[model samples]
Target: MSNHRQAKDPRLQKISSQLAAHGLILRGGFVFGDGEAALEPSEARPAKSVLLVGQAGAAPWPYFLGWREQQPRDLQNPLDTWSREVIDMVAAHFSAWTVYPSDKPYQPFQQWAMRAEGLKPSPLGILMHPEYGLWHAYRGALLFADEIPIPDIHDPIHLCDQCVGKPCLKSCPVDAYSGDGFAYQSCLAHVRGTDGEPCRAGGCLDRNACPYGTGYRYPADVQAFHMASYAGL
Candidate 1:
C-alpha cells in the first residue's frame, strides 16, 4: 500500500493548512498511474499525483454560509459551487488542477477516498470515518503534475464493528434499511411525507442514532439542508 515517495515535502503541509483555513481537509492522496487514472480536464497537465479534499463534521458550514450570503440570488448547487471556488483557488495557488465529485463524466471520488483514507462503508453506504463517523464528506481534489510525498494511511478500526446494538439500522421508522439492503424509494417517501418531519428537520434518525462521533455530528440546519436535497425538496 505504501508506494509513493517517502521524502518529507513542505508543500503537503502548506496545502493542508491552506485548505483547513477554508474548512477543508486533505483527506489523503496517491500517486497517479502512467498517463491516465482519473478523468482530468482537457486543459490539465499530465497529472502525477492527486490530493483528495473534504470536510469533517460541521467544519465548513459556517464558512460556506458566509460565502453563500455574498453569492448571487437563486444560486444552484451552492455548496458544490462554493467548494469548487475555494478549492480552485487553492489549486491555482499551488499550480494544480481541480476536479469535483459532481464534475462531468463523474470522477471516481468514492474510490479515491477509500484509497486515500482506508475507510469502509457503513450500513448507510456512506464511508464511516474513525473519528468523524458519518459526518465527513469528499468535496473535491487537487491534481499535481509532479508526485508529492503522500502520507501513509493508517487504517483505523471500523466503528460499526464495535457497536453491538447497531442503532442506525433500527432507528428508521420505515425500516428503510434491512438485511436485503437500503430501500431508497421507501426512505425517500418517508422523508418527503407528513410523518417525515422529524427526519426532515433533524436529519436521519438512524444516522443520528450511531453512537460514535456524536460530537462531530452536523448541526440541525446542515442536516436539514442535506435532507432537503436528498428528498429533492
Candidate 2:
C-alpha cells in the first residue's frame, strides 16, 4: 500500500489548528511579483514566497522571556530558532516560504491576500486580535500553492478610540508619533542623542505607553534593538 495525500492537503487545517493552540496565528497570501523591487539598498532578499506571517500571542510571553531575557547574550539565537520553526511549519502547509519583518516596505501578505482576492484594507489591520494594539508583529511568513480562505478583511479598530490618555502619541519625549503619523527622524535623534534620559536607558517611551498587549510586550532590550535598527545605528 502507498500513502496518498492530495497536494493541496487538508492536513494543513490540522497543522494550522495546532499552531493556533501554540499561540501562533497563520495568515496567507500570494508572493508579491516585485519582490526584488521592494528590497532596500542594504537589505538582502530574506525569502522567496508570497508569505504566511505567524505571531505568537501574549500567552507565550513567559516562554518568550525564558529565551529573550535569560539568554540575553544569545537573543538572536532563540528568536531565530522560533522564527525558523514557524517558517518551516508554514512551509509544510504551503508551496513556498519567506520570512521578513512586518515593518518592511513590502506589502503585508494579508493585504496581498486581499488584493489577489479583490479586497481592501478595511479599517483595521488583518487578524484583528483585540489585545495586541497594532504592536504585535509578523515574526515570519510563508507562501502557498493556492489562496487560503480568510475572514473578509475588516477595518482595524483604532486603538485610540479606547485609549483615554492616548499616551502612545504623547509619551514620546520628542513627540515622534503624531496623531497623523510618525516623525521618524525625530524619534531616531531622541533615542540616539546624548540626552542621557530614561527613554534611552529603558526603551521606546511611546511603545511602552501602548495600553494593549500589556502582557505580550516585547522585552526592553528587544525594543531597544528594534529602535536602534530603525534609527539605522
Candidate 3:
C-alpha cells in the first residue's frame, strides 16, 4: 500500500478500539528493516511494519477467564491459546500478519518491546515501565504489508534507578533476585516448597514489592494463575 493510502487508513484506530474491547492495547509499533525474518512462513514478502499488542495489568484477566471457561478442560497453555485466538481475530479483520511470543521461531519480542517503547529491564529482568512497573505484558503483534504511522516515543526515566532502597531484591525469601541476576533454580525450588506458599499463591514477592504501578498490580487470583503456570502445576 502507498504511504498516501496508509495515511488515510482508519485501520489503526479501529484496531485499537476492537482490541480494547477484549482488554488488549496496541503497545506501539516499528517499521521493520529490510530482510528481517518477520514474514509468514509461506510468504516471500516481508511485512513492512508491526504493531505490538498486549495487556497492561489485570485488564485482560476477566476477558481471558471468560474465554477459558468455554474451552476444553484439558487444554494446556490456556492463556497463550486465548491470546492467539483473540489477536488472530483482530489481525484477520485488518488483513495483517499475526505473531506470538510462543511461536516456534521465537520472535524477538523483548528486543522489539525495548525498541518500540523505550523501556529497560529492571534488576528482576522484567522490563520496568515508568507507569506500569512489572504488571504489564506483550501478548502478540500484528504485522502490516505497508509502513504505518507509529507514535513517537520519548525516553522515560528508568524507575529502578530512582527507587530508594530497592525493596524488590530484598523481598524474595531465597534471594533469587539480585544485581548479579536471577537464580532460576533457587526461585523454582523455593516456590515449590511449603514455605513458598506466599509466593505461590500471590505471585512473585519481588515483583509485588515494587512500589511503582501498585494500582495496576494483578489481582490475587490472576497472580495465582500465573504462579501456577510458572510452577508447571
For model 2, residues 43-97, the per-residue Cα lDDT tens digits are 3433333435556344444445564565556354465566666567556654454
Residue 187 CA error for candidate 2 (Å)?
Answer: 1.1
lDDT score of residue 217 within candidate 1: 97
lDDT by residue for model 3 (101-211), tens? 988788899999998899999888899999899999999999888778775678988999999899998899999987678899999998999899998899999999999
TM-score, cand. 3 vs. native: 0.93
- On TM-score, the stronger of 2 and 3 is 3
Per-model CA lDDT versus the true structure: 0.88, 0.53, 0.88
TM-score (C-alpha) between model 2 and the true structure: 0.59
RMSD of each: 1.7, 8.0, 2.6
TM-score of 1: 0.93
Error of 3 at 26 (Å): 0.5
**Ranking of all candidate structures by their TM-score, best first:** 1, 3, 2
For all predicted structures, in order, the TM-scores are 0.93, 0.59, 0.93
Which 10 consecutive positions of candidate 1 have the poorest summed lDDT?
Answer: 32-41
